[model samples]
Target chain A: MNVPLLNVSGATRRFGGLVAVNEVSFEIGPGQVCGLIGPNGAGKSTMFDLITGVRPLSSGSIHFMGRDVTQEPAHSRSPMGMSRTFQIVRLFPGMSVLENVLMGFQPKFPDGVIRSLFGIGRLGGQERDARQRAYEILDFVGLADRAGDRIDELTLGQLRLVDIGRAMAASPRFLMLDEPAAGLNDAETNNLAEMLARLKADGLSMLLVEHDIDFIMNACDKIVVMDRGTKIADDIPARVRTNDAVIAAYIGKRAHDAQH
Target chain B: MPLATKRASVWPVVAVLALGVALPFLLSGGFQLRIAMLIWIFAILSMGFNLLYGYTGQISMGQQGFYAVGAYAFALLQIKLGLSPVLAFAGAVAICAVLGLIVAYPLLRLRTHYLAMATLGFGLILNGVANRWIDFTGGTAGLTVPPLTWGGEALGRTGIYYVVLAIAGVVFLLHDFIARSHVGRALQAIRDDETAAAALGVPVRRYKLRIFVLAAAIAAVAGCCFSVVSLRVDPSLGEFHILVSMLTIAVVGGLGTRFGPLIGAAIVTILPQLLLQFGAAETLIYGAFIVLFLLFIPHGLAGLVENVRWTRKSAAPARTAATNVLEVKG
Candidate 1:
C-alpha cells in the first residue's frame, strides 16, 4: 500500500520508424526485487536506457520518490538516488580499482570552481569523507585487497562486481542493473544473488534485467515478462510460472528449443 | 602517507627552483642570462598547453591568440598609456582570462580536428587584426614595450631571469596542485571515458570550459613575461609560424606530467642554439631531430622514463609467468 519508490507510466521510445519500447508501465516499491524477463530483442535494455536518461524517451514519464524526473540528465539523477550499471561493463580502465568507486562519489561533492580554486569551505571535508566511503564500498564488494590494482587487470566477473560496487557507492535508493549475471559462472552467479539479497534487505529497490532464468527465479520476488517490446505478464513468480501468455511467448519456445 | 608523498614532491621542486634561481649567478654573462629568461618564458607557455591537450584532452591551436592578446594588452598599457609594467602585466593576464571565457563557450563544444581548426582560425584572425590595425598594433613593424623597473632601476638580464624563474615556480606549483585535486581526477575520468564520467555525475562541458580558460590565462601570463623580457610585442606573436604552437614544450617532453613542459622547453630552446654551431645546416638538423623524436617517441622523453619504470616493475612477474608456463609444458 506504500507508494512505489520508482514509477514509470506509459513510457515509450522510438528510433526512426521502429518502436523500441511501447508504453511500458511498471512500479517498484522500496526493498522490492523485480525481474524484467524477456526474449532476445524484447527492448528491455532500451527501457532501462530510457529510465536512466542514457537515451531519451519519446513520450511518457518516470517518477522517483514522488518527483517527476523524466527530463533530468543522468548526472542530475544520481544526486536524487538513481543509479545504473551498464550491460557492457564500462569502467575507467586506466584508473585504480579504488578510484573507479571514487568516481561514483562525484555527485556527492560540491563541484564549484571558485571553491575548488580557494580550497576553502566544506568541499575539503566532503572530499575526505567521500574517499573514506569509497574505500569502505570497495571493501564491501570484496575487492579490498585489489584496491590498488588497475581495472584492466580485473577479470570479467570481478569487473561486474566492481561495476555493482561503483553503483552501490552512489548510495542509490533505486538500482537498475543491466545483465549483471550475463557472463558470470555458477559460483559467481550465486555470489551475486547473495549480494543482491543483502542490498534488498538494506531497503534498496532493484530492477534486475537478466537472461539467467534460474538466477532470477531464485532471487526475484516478482517477474515482468516481455516479448517483442510489450509486457505480457506481471505477477508473483508462482502465478507468472503458469501464465499462458508467458508460457506461449517465452517458456514454450525455450522448451521447444531445449528438445533439439 | 600523504605527508610522505608531499615531501617526495616538495624536494624535487625545491631543487629545481634552487637551480633556476642560481643559474644567472653561475653564468653571470648577459647573453646567457637572456637565453635563460627566454627558456623560462617558453616553459610557462608549454605548461599552459599541457593543461589543455594533455590533461583535458582538448586540442587547442589558438594558444598564440591568448599569448598575442596579453602581449598587446601589456604593450598598449605601457607604450600608449605609459603605465607601470608590473601592473600592466597583471591587467593583461586578467583581460586574457575574460577573453578566454568568452571564446570557450563557443569553441569548447568542438572536438578533435574541428576544434583544432577552429582555434587555428581564431589565431589567424588575431594575426590579421594585428597586421592591419597599424595605429594600435604597430602593424607588421611590431610594438616596443618598455622594460620593467623596480624603484627607478631597470631590471637587467639577470633580474629578468630571476623574475621569470619566480613566475615559472608559481605556475608549476599551481599546475601540480590542480592536477592532483578533485577537479583534475574528474577531468581525467572525462578524458578516459566521458560517457561513464557523465553517468557518475561529472559536469563534462563545464570542466572542459574551465580547463580552456585556465590554459588561456596561463598562456597569457607567459606572453606578458615574453614581452617584458624581449621589450617588444609583434603581430607575428599571433601568427602560427615556426610550428610554434605544435612544438609546445609539454608535448616534446611528455604530455601530462608536470615537469615535462619545463624539460621540453629547456631542450627546444637550447637545442636550436646549440645546433647553430653548424651554421646554415643547423635548421636542417633541428627539423630532422624533431621529426625523429615525433616518429619514434610519440609520448616523448617523460613517457620514456615512465616506460622504463613500468618495464622494470613488470619484469619479475613476466619472468615468473614464463617459467611456470615452461614447467607446465614439461
Candidate 2:
C-alpha cells in the first residue's frame, strides 16, 4: 500500500469497565481524503487522540510516515509533519489570529530560547517570513481580513477555519480533523469541503471525523465506519454506503430497506 | 472587535517612567527616599513575579525563595569568596536560574491550586534552610552587605540609585521584548490551553520552565539590589510574608497587564506607610483593600482599565467577548 501515510493496528482504550475504543485499525493512503464516521461516543475522537499521541492506547500502536510514533509526544509529532485540530475549537483567546498561526510555524525553526531572547535569531528576518507564511495561510482559509482579530471576535465557523489554518500552518504531511463541521452551517460546510478538495489536490493526506454524513459522503474518497470502537467497514464511499455492517451500525436499518 | 485594532496605549507607560524618574526629586527626606527605594526594589521583584503569574498564568508563591537565594549567594560570593560585587550578583542570578529550572520540572507538573501549594512548600523549605544553616547563612542574624564599590570608592546613595534604575530599566526592556516576541506568544498559548498549545507544537513544559527560570533570575537580581539597599541579607528575606506581599502587588496592579507590577508595587509599598496612623490596624486595612480589589475588580486595576477601554466603543461585543474569554475553564 506504498506505506500508508498513517497506520494504526489493534488500537484499544478502556476507561474502567468501558472499552472506549476496541481494537480499531485503519490507514490513509497519500493524497486520500478519508472520513471516520460513527454514532456519537463511538470512539472516533478517541482514535484521533491516540493517533496524535494525545492519549495512549490500552493496546496496539500507531505508525506515521513509516515510523513507529506511538510512544512519541504530541509536540514531537508536529515537526515530523503531523497536525490535528481539537473537537472543542481551542484557540488562544487573548492572542490575535496572526499570533496563533505564528505558533504553528514556530516549531519548524530551530531557534533556541537564548537565541529567541537575544533577537539575533531573526526576530526580524524569520519573524517576517513567519508573518508572510501566516498571512498566506490566513488568505487560503479566507480569513486574511480578520488576521488581526482575536478569537473572541470569530464566529463558530470562523473559529473552525482558524483551527484548520493553525493546523495547516505547520505544513503537515498529514492532518487529522475531529468534527470540523459540527456547528458549521451548510454554506460553511460547503466552504470547508471545497478547502478539503483543494488540499487533496495538493497531495496532502487527511483523516476527518465528522458527524455531517452528507458532507462526509460527498467529500471523502474513502469512508471508514466504526461501531462500539471497532472498524465495521472501510472502502470507497460507494461500497461503504451499501456495506451491511456499516448501514446497520451507522446508516440505520432503514438504509438496509433502501439497499435491498 | 471593539478597539481590538487599537494598539495598546504607550502614554501610560511613559507617564509611569516619568513618575519613577521624578520620585528622588519629589522626596527630599532620607526616610522618604528610603521608602521610595523600597518601592523600586519591590517593583523589580513584582515585575519578575508578573512574568510567571500574569503572562504565563502560573501561580508561584515561592518567589521570595529566589530573592533570598540571590541575596545570600551575592553576599557569600563577595564576603567569603572575595569576588567583586558585580560578578557576585551575576553568579547569584545564575544560581537562582539554575534552581528555577531544576524546581520547575517536578513542581510545574501540578496545576493551579496544587501548583500554588507546591510553590508555597518550596518557599517554606528554602526559608527553613536559611534559618538552620547557621555556618553558611548565619541563620536568623544573616550577613551584612558592604556598600557596592568601584575602584575602592563606595558608590554613594546617588550612584546606587542610578545603578538600581539602570538595572531596572534593562529588566523592563528585556521583559517588554519577551512580551512582544514569538516566545511570549508561545507562553500565552500555553497559558490559554496547554493541550492545544502542545498540539500546535509549543513545547509546553520547556516554555514554562524557560519563563520560570527567567522570572527567577529577575527576582534574584531584585534580591541582590534589596540586600545592597538594606545593607544585610537576613533569613526573613525568604519568609512567606515576602511571597504574600509580592503576590498581592501582582494581583492588585493587574495580573497580566504591562506596567502592572510597578503600579502594584507602588500601592502595596506606600499603602502601609499611609495606614501607620491606625497603628496595628494597618494590617487589617491592607488586608481589607486586597479583599475589596479581589471581590470588586477581579481582573485587578489593569483589568479595570481594559474593561473601560473595551466598553468605550461598543459594550455589547465587549461584554460577550469578556464572558467568552472568562468561560475558558483553565
Candidate 3:
C-alpha cells in the first residue's frame, strides 16, 4: 500500500516468562486509520507500548515514517511527529484545558530562562500565537467552549476528548490513540468516531487501539485482529467480520458454531 | 488564553510594590524597619525557593545550608579578605550558585524524598563545617563583621531597608513575569507529571537544574542580607529549624501562586515576632501552623485569595464555577 507510514515485522514482547505479544506483524499506510482490536489481555496495549516506545520489545523492529524507532525512548519519539494518549488519560493536572493543549506544543516553546524573565524576544507574542492556535485545536475537537475549564471539571468523555485535543496540538503527522473509546457512552463513542472521520479527512494518519469492535468496524479503513498475543487476521472491516478464525476467537468454537 | 488573566494580575503586583515603598515611612518603632527588612529578605529568598519547590515540584530540605554558605561567604570575604561589601555580595552569590549546580547535578537525579534527604545532608554538612572550622568560621560563637556599607558609606536602617526593598521589588516583578510565561507552564507541567512533560520535549533535567541553582543563589542572597543586617555570620543560620521556617513561608504563602511567597513570608516572619514571649516553643508553633495550613488549606494563602476573588467575581452568579476553577488552578 502507498509506501506504508509505519512498518512492523515480527514485533514480539516478553514479560519474564510470559510472551505478551508474539511475533505480531502489521503496517499502516499514508492517511489510513488502522484499528488494532482484541479482547482483554490480547496484547493490544503491549503492541501500542512497543510502537510508541513506551516499552522496548524483546525482539522486533518498528519503522515510523521510514526511520527505525525501535531503540528510541518514549520522549524522543514525540518530536519526530509521533504523539500518543494513555489509556487512563494522563493529563497535566492544575492546568486548564487550553493550557493542557498549549503544553503539547512545548517543543515549539523557546528554551530561554533569561529571555522569559526579561519578557524579551517576543515571548508574549509567541504565547499569544500558541494560545490562538490552541483555541483552534480545541474548536477542531468540539471542545472549544470547554477551553477554560479545569481538568477535574470535565467529565470522563470530555477528558478523553481533551486528551485528543492535546495530542493534536503537537502537530503530529501520525497519531496513536490507546482506547480513545474506553469508558465512553454510546453518544460519546459516536462523537469520537465522527471526530476520527474528520481527522482522516484532514489527512492525518492514526492507529487506534480500541475494544469497541463495532466502532472499530465502522471507523477503520483496515482492521488488525489480535487474539492472545497473536495476529489472527488482517483485512478490511467487512471481510474480517466474516472470517471463521475471528469469530472463533471472539466467541469460542461452540458459540461460533451456534452463531453460524 | 486572553489577557484577562494577565491584565488582572498587573494591578495586585503594582499595589503590593507601592505598599512596600510606603511601609517604611509608616513605621515609627526603632526595630519596626528591621522587621520589614526581615520580611523583604525572606520574600526574596522564598521567591526563588518557590520557583524550585513550588513551581518545579522539587521539594528541598537543605536550603538553609545554601543560606548559611551565602552568609558565610559574604561575611568571610569582607572580614577576612577585606573586600568591598558590594563586591563580596556578588562573589558570595556566585559561589553558592556554583555550589548549587555541583550539588544539583548529582542530587536532582534523585526524585522527591531522596533529593530532599540529599539536600538536607548537604546543609547539615555545611553547618558542621561552620561549627568546627573555628579558624575561618570563628566556631559556634560566630564571626562578627563591620556594618553593611555601600561604596565607602555605611547604610543606616532606613537606607538598607530601601535598598533591600528595591532589589526585592525587582525580584518580585521578575517572579510575576515568570509565573505568566510559557516557561512557567513547562515548570508546572514538570511538576504535575514529569513523564508527560518530557513527552512534550520539555528538557526536564535542564529545567530542574536551573531552578535548583536559582533557588540556591536566592537563598545565599538571603543569608548575605542577614549578615549585613546583623553584622555577623554563624553556624546557627544554617540550622534545620531555619529551613523548616523557610518551607513554612513557601507553603503558607501558596505553593505556585505568584504572590504566595511574599504573603507567606509576611505571615511566618511577622507572626513569630509577635509571639516572641513564647521563645521556648517557637519550633512547636511552626509545626502546628504548618500542619494547620496543610490539613485545612493546603493551597495556602494564595488559594484563599483566589477563593475570595472567585466568590466576589460570582457575586452576580454569572460564569460557571468551572471557569474560575481553571482561572485560579492555572
Candidate 4:
C-alpha cells in the first residue's frame, strides 16, 4: 500500500543460543499506526531495536520510505526521518525541558560549522528559529510552562509525554515507540492514546510496541502479535478479536473464558 | 544546562575573566606571575579535559599523554626543523590533532572505566616513550625550549604570561560556546543517555571522537604554553601525577559547569603554594583540601556558587503529572 512506509522481511535476532525474534516480517503504510504486542520475553522491544537501527538484526532486511536501511546507523537514520522513544524514559538529565527537545533539532551542522567549531557561531540565524520551534513543540507536549524548569522536576507520566514531544521534535515520517504507556496510569494512558490518534489523523506513521492490549486494540489500524519470539498473528482488530488461534495464543482459553 | 539556569552563572565567569586579566598587574613578582601562569596553563588543560569527561561523559585520565606529545612536538620542531616558536607550537597542535584522531577511533570504542583504563594506559606508554626515547626527547634530562621572540627580543616573563592568559581566554571562549550551543546540548544528551541520543540522531561516536580530539588538541596547546614558560619537556610531564592533577582541577572546579575549570585552577594552583611555608604540611593540606572539596562540594567549586543547577531529565515524569495533560487540554 503506497510502497509500505516500513517493510521488514524476515527480521531475526538471536542472542547466543536464544533466538529473541525469529523470522518476523511486517509492513506499515503511510499514516498508519501499527501496534506490536506480545507477552513478556516475546522480543517486542528487541524487534523495535532492530527496526530503529539501535541493534543490528541477526539476519533479514529492513526498508524504510522506499530505501533499504538494514545497515544504516541510528544517528543517520534519525536525520532521514526515523525517530523513537525508549521503554525506559531516556531524557537528558540536568537540562531544561526545552533543551531536551531542542536537541531534536540539529540546525544541520554544516550551516555555520566553522563558527560552531571556533565557539563564535552562536547559531544566530538558525538557532532563533530552532528555539521558536522548540517552544511551540513544548507547548504541544503540554509542558509549555515547564519549559524552563529543570527536566528532573517532571513526573513519570510527564516524562513519557516529553519523550513523545522529543520524538515529534524531529518531524519524523516514521516514529517507533517502545512501551510509551508502560508506566503510565489510566489517565496518562488515555492521554497517550489520544495523542497517537491525533498524530495518525495528521498522517504521521508510527510503530507502537506495547503490553497494554486494550490501548493497542483501540489505537492501531492493525496489530502484530508475537509469543516466544515468533509472530503468531497479524490482522486488523475486528478479525483478530475472534480468531481462534489469536485468542488461544494471546488471551489463552482460561483468560478468554473469563472475558466472555 | 537548561536555557534559564545557564544564564544564572554568568557573573562568576565575568569576575574570573576580569581577575585573570588584572592578575599580572596585581602580582609584580615573576615568581608569583609564574604561579599565575601555572594556574592559567592548568586552567586550559582543565577546560580540555572537562570537554571530554564533563560535557561529553567520556573519561580520559591520561591527558598528560597528549600534553607531553605536544610539548615534545613543540621543542623538536623549533630545535630540529628550525621552525619559529609560533610555527612550532602550531606544528605541535597539528600533530596533536592528528594523534587524537588516530587514537580516538580505537580508544573511544570503549566505554566508561574501560575507556578510562585504555586512556590511562595510553598515557603510561607515552610517558615511557618520552622517558626512554633519549635521542629525541632527552629522557628525564628534558628538552630546553627557546623563549618566544617578539620583535627579535625575548617576550620575557610578563609577555609570556599575557600570552598564556590570551590563550586561556581563547580556550575559555571555545569551551563556553560549546557548553551553550546546540552542540553542547547534544554532548550532554550523549552523556546523559547515549542510546536515546543516537535514536534522536546525534552522531554519538562522531561527537565523542570530536570532543576527544578537541581535548587532545587543547592539552597540546597547554603543553606548548608550558614550554614557553618553563622551557622544559620531560617524562614527568606525562606521568600519572600530572594526569591526576589535571583531573583534580576539572573535578574540583566542576565537571560540566561554566566556571569550574577556571575557579578550580585558581584554587588548586594557589592552595599548595599558600601552604608551602608549612613545608611537610603542604602536601597534607593540599590533599585535605581536595578531599574536603570532593566530599563537601561534590558538584565542584562552580556548582557551589550557582544554587539553581540543571538536572538531567529522566524518562519517567513525576506521578503528580499523570493527569497533568488532561488539565492542559481542558
Per-candidate TM-scores read 0.87, 0.87, 0.87, 0.91
lDDT of each: 0.77, 0.80, 0.81, 0.81
Query: What digit string (tens of lDDT, one per residue) describes model 4 on residues B1-330?
Result: 334722233355567778888988899689999999998899998889888888777889778999999989999999999998889988999999899998898989777678889988888889989988889889899999888889989888889988998888889877887776777778887777677778888888888888899999999999998888998888888888878888788668777877788888888888888898999888988888888877777778777665446223122223213323432442
Clashing pairs in 1: none
- Listed models, DockQ each: 0.28, 0.37, 0.31, 0.40
Q: Once superposed on the true structure, which residue ranges of model 2 sit more than 4 Å away at CA?
A: A1-3, A10-19, A109-112, A118-121, A251-260, B1-29, B274-292, B304-330
Q: Taking the tens digit of each residue's C-alpha lDDT, what string does model 2 give over A100-133?
A: 7778986865554577666655566777788888
CA shift at A213, candidate 2, in angstroms?
Answer: 1.4
Q: Rank the candidates by DockQ, best first.
A: 4, 2, 3, 1
- Shift in Å, residue B79, candidate 3: 4.2
- For model 3, residues B1-330, the per-residue Cα lDDT tens digits are 221222225678899999989987899975988988898888888888888877777878888999899999998898889998788989999999999999999998776677788888998899999999999899999988778666677888888887778778877887887777778888887777666676676778888999899889888888888887788878999997788777788668777778888999899888878777788898688678789888877678885775432112111112223333433442
**Interface residue Cα RMSD of candidate 4 after superposition:** 4.1
DockQ (C-alpha) of model 2?
Answer: 0.37
lDDT of 4 at B218: 96
Worst 10 residues of 4 chain A by lDDT: A106-115
Give one digit per residue, the lDDT tens place, for model 2 in B1-330. 432333344456556667767777887777777777777788888877887877777778899999999999999999999988889999999999999999898998776678889988998999999999899999999999988887789877766776777777777766666665666667767677777888988788888888889889998999999988888999999997898888788678876667677778888888999999999999899889999987886666765665532122122223333534553521
In candidate 2, which residue pairs get closer than 3 Å at backbone N, Cα or C atoms, i.e. clash? none
Lowest lDDT block of 10, candidate 4 chain B:
B311-320
Worst 10 residues of 1 chain A by lDDT: A251-260
Predicted model 3 interface RMSD = 6.4
Per-model clash counts, in order, read 0, 0, 0, 14
